[model samples]
Target: MHVRFTLQIFAVALLVSTTAARAGILRVYPGESIQAAIDAANPGDTILVEPGEYYEDAGSIYGLRITTDNLRLIGKSKNSHSHPSDKAGQMSNRVRLIANGAQETGVYVAPAGCEYKNSACAEELQGFYLRGFSVEGYPANGIQTRWVNGFQFVRNVSVNNLNNGIYPTLSANGLVRDNISYGSLDTAMWVAGSENIRVIGNELFGSVIGFEITVSNQVQASHNKIYDNTVGIGLFHPNGAGNPPLPVMENWVIEHNHIYDNNRPNDAPDGSFQADLPPGTGVLLMGVSNHVVGKNRVANNGFVGIGILGWCSATTGTDNSCETRPPISDPAANDNQISLNTLNGNGESPPGGILDFLAADLVYFQLEVTVGAGNCFKNNKPEGLTFVSSAPNGELPSDNC
Candidate 1:
């Protein structure tokens, strides 16, 4: 038998092997429409797609629109964890959802007329699972979900999506793991305005922000390889951004990840929120609170590593200062614990137009919104030729909470 048929059989066998095999199983062969299968599927049904390119029959705006809850969409992959540029000739054995220039999103997962922020949403998708596919070339987002309550994305590759690669916005109880995303105008994976989310074991690169936790709460990012982006990871709370700021960005745990060499130029549009990024930045904590950052390997970023600053004080190359437009509330970096991180070979040279004095392995700008309520750093070990660290806007945040 041909290896293709053998792989297909193996994939179907894995699908049916599940003990809780629910409802029914639908198969969409190559050249068949995924949307048709979705339309025909029930709420708890599972759909298996063959290893082929899906481009022509996609919807006008979305390549695949998933509105049903508890739906499982899986793909047959030769090797699920391999990248497209691998030397092995295995790229053709994976399911690929492609979008044309006119398309906006590759996979759009949200209920109809959903506005959970305004309480107008009728239903939120729950228990959705997607696995083992490649989504790319969409203008807006590759895999986008909003108002989703228990969703999981696993072992997927997202590439060259002009905007966000995998974006989970206004969601909760979500897990994004073992995914690869790269080459985006915006963030590779942005967990924005969401809660109870965990982003782990993903590789992100070549975007404005590799992985960002923006105005979110109770989220955690760990064991992800983030590199070659404008900023590796941004923990930001940007105020006056279209809508009212969400609840304080708090209760985050960032550790055990490798963030390095993120020196790409900022690709976000001018005057946008991320446009002011100076590049060579690793794990910036801005206007957030109650975070625990430790035990990560951050190296060779060339500008800063694990910097913590408040809203009004962190500025670079952007002439529009916070003095021009201050926030309603003091969005300071408060009550954070930065400890036990390893930094190496950072801040030999700052990026152009950035203040030369502000670059270091561990930077802390002490713009205290509330007196004595500040971040504390302790037991961080820096290693380099001359140890080009120990420079902060004030004294190192050690022993000063």
Candidate 2:
């Protein structure tokens, strides 16, 4: 029976590869719409679009209304396709795709519109590969996915956009690698409520929300070169009615990243929009738990480096008090481990430090210290670390730093 199960798994993997390879070779023309080809594509098929301009109306090309899984969208040009020589010591060709229409998102992954009900979306899609494509000029997001699994985005690029370069919502087990994401007023990438996801070996520059991960669980973000972003890496929660409160977001690992020179001035007319500042910081963890942020080189942030701010909000509570103090604090945001990070010339602009831990409202504890509050930290090396507590004692000594 064990052997049988193993064989079954192998067979499934083989089927996946077979379908993927078949899908990889199908060529799409200039006159034919990319969406139509994707709609006709079967699972495990590759759709190759030649080098040319393709016009699309709002919404996604593949699996726009219906949820289609296991599809690979690639390019046919040397610039769009993988470079011929692996070790050529040369810049590989880049695929340039121009979007000429208004849409909610450039390339999105979700169930069909028919699946939209009440306030929830269909969650039956998984395993989409979007490569060698350039997406631009979207009304909302560049790429949006929700409730899917096993997505691979490689060697694709986006520019001159309005929203996020890539937005994946409520997904599990995906990868964003070797891509260039830029020229957006909004986030470069925004991921929420995801698990087992990775953002590695990508270049993100010039965006409102660069590398924003909020309300997520069990994610790993590392080894990517992030620069010139307003909020290099952001983690937060959205306010609304009947919103699912954040549960314990656990087992998140952030390591080996080069985050530098992120402090860009906020372009939003309203000062309340804080997502667009290019402050130099590696990781910002709020409303999250069981996270590990280490081995990163962070520098030149306008504000504090590696900030940990715990705030609360209530759905059903006294008027506007929930904005300041929710009836319940997110239990998950507590308890984290941060260590082994290199900080250089950080906090040049304002209240800055290599590390800053700001917590409030739980009146029992004193200030200036972080320990024994159901959270733990050890072996942290920040050039200038500061621990700020609003509680009574309100401050951990420099030793804790």
Top candidate (lDDT)? 1
Residues 184-261 of candidate 1 have per-residue lDDT tens digits of 888899887788999999999989999988667899889999999989998875562333456556788999999999
Runs of candidate 2 exceeding 4 Å displacement = 1-24, 58-66, 79-95, 114-118, 238-243, 269-282, 312-333, 351-377, 382-401
Give the range where candidate 1 is weakest over 10 consecutive residues by summed lDDT: 383-392
**Global fold similarity of model 2 (TM-score):** 0.76
lDDT of each: 0.79, 0.59
* 176-281 per-residue lDDT for model 2 (tens digits): 8887777677677766767778888877777755677766777787887777776677665443111254565566777888777776655532423343233444
All candidates: TM-score: 0.87, 0.76
Clashes of each: 0, 23
